[model samples]
Target: MKLVVRVKLLPTPVQAAALEATLHACNQAATWAAGVAFEENARRPLELRKHAYAEVRVRWGLGAQAAQHAIKKSCDAYTTLKANLRNGRYGRPGTKRHARASGKPVVFRPEAAQPYDDRMLSWQHQARTVSIWTTAGRLKGVRFTGQAEQVEVLAAHRQGESDLVCQGGKWFLIATCEIPEGDLNTHPDGFLGVDLGIVNIAATSDGARHCGRRINRKREQDRKLRSKLQKKNTKSAKRRAKKYAGKEARRAKDINHKISKRIVAEAERTGRGIALETLTGIRERARLRKPQRTTLHSWPFAQLGSFIAYKAKRAGVPVVYVDPAYTSQECSKCHHIARGNRPAQAVFSCRVCGFVEHADHNASHNIAHRGWYVWVCGAQSTAPGLTLIA
Candidate 1:
């Protein structure tokens, strides 16, 4: 498995200015290359490089590799534009988008992203520092922080490229790390079914509920704060809104990580496969009332599902996806599906068999049962204790 792990870079004031200048210079070179490529109809990297190389190096004072990076960036954009034109999605002769603007970034790609060969980038485990290549010069020691476990992975399997990114007054390094596909191990005796809900976050067949009250509270607070800030429309308010937005995103991501860790830990403890409902086209297919619509739109179902999958894979837990259709409305007790079975958001009562349960819990049971149907047909688990579960 290859993971793009984020490492927060702490640069000195002088180093920070240098990095900012290098970034802007690289982006400007890339942008200029894009313009020249369009004007000359340069369709290939080599062609764009030939056209832009002299100007980029002379004007931006970018190193050789940096010049190549900018040209490649421009070539990529032109290639994408040509592809879209060929597919008739955006650009075509005499169409509204025929003269499409190439919105190229001012950052170097390919070469700007340092490869983890000894020359351009290096890692110092003891000092927790990193080396990065910049157009200005090579920065020898940039302090950084990341999840310890992921950093340990970096020590073993750090790949060849990492991108330098700046956001909210901080620099970040996103390094690619690779792990073997066959390294994962799994025990498939039983399975745990997870039902995802906006209000509940997640409810498992094992009777575990990861509540969403606190998450909802934080989201509501942020929403109100942002609304007020936007209304004020002042410099301070704009700054505060931007800061709050980033903080809220981190908080949500942290919650997803924690919740996924717990879910995977449980699956590992029980030696059971993890099961989740497939979320394909869910937002488009489902019709809901106004309040339910708000909750569904705000919910981070896709992010949470992705977190569960990657963490489960890392932990050697088998993950299965089941169809989400009618999982909530189906009664686990009687195998009956009806809209009336769930009278309220959190309350589920079977109309046919008079079976009642917490709505999310019941849905989780249904999902688990459905997933077992998938597992039994395809799974090779022949353990003595392997039994059907609902």
Candidate 2:
């Protein structure tokens, strides 16, 4: 499994200036290369490099490797743009949104992230410092800090390119670490179903609920603040809004991480596999009122699911996805499906069996049952000579 470990860089004022200049020069060179590629219709890296390499080195005063990276970055930007266009991310071909994206050459910001290969950047884990190339000169002894475990992982398993990122005037290097996965757990005692919702972020079949009330309140407050700032439209207000732009997102990500870690730990301890809903195209199919739409769209259910998946993989815990259709309305006791089963957001009542339970909890039970059925069927199909009875 590949994981990213980020370390904060603490550069001296002189080193910072050099890094800043290098970033600006590289981005300018990349922007120029992209323009050249757009005009000549050269999308391939090698083809664009042929046209932009020499000019980049001479115009930007970059070294051989830096010049190559700059040209490659430009080509990568165009490749990503082309992919997004084909995927209909910007809109249909004749739409104004699509034209706005496809009409112009890609431009790179001055502080855009730049990739550093081994030859251009070297790390000294023992000293917690790095040496990197710059337009001014080769910079040495730039200090960095990170969590103890993260630093250890970076020292042991780091590989490939590291990206130099500047965010909110802080410098960070995102290093890729390739970690080995544990042996797979083929046999599981049972599946621990997780039901995702807007009100409660996650509800486990074991009757555990990771509530999102606090986080949602915090997000609502932030949204109101941002709305006020936008209405003001002053320079200071805009700066404040920019400063707080990702605060809620970071909080949500941290919450998801904690929730996933706990869930994976519990499942592993009990020797149980994790079951989750296959929620693809959920937003497209969901219908909600104006007030509820914001809450629905802002919730990070996908992030929570992905976090659970990767953590489970690391722990050798099996994971399965089950169909989510009618899970909420179906009664876990009698399997009666009806729209009237859910009288409230939090209550589940089966008219046929007179069974009552929490809506999310009942849904999780259904998910676990379906997951068990799927697992048994799959196991039977795979092992024809061996028989396992449910």
TM-scores, all models, native as reference = 0.85, 0.95
Q: Model 2, stretches more than 4 Å misplaced? A: 377-390
Highest lDDT, which number?
A: 2
Per-residue error for 292 in candidate 2, Å, reads 1.6
* TM-score of model 1 vs. true structure: 0.85
lDDT digits (tens) for residues 263-361 of candidate 2: 999999999888889878889878888877898898788877878887787788888888999999999999999999999999999999999999999
Give all candidates' CA lDDT scores.
Answer: 0.76, 0.88
lDDT of candidate 1 at residue 94, scale 0 to 100: 69
Tell me the lDDT of model 2 at 115: 93
Model 1, 362: alpha-carbon shift in Å?
1.2
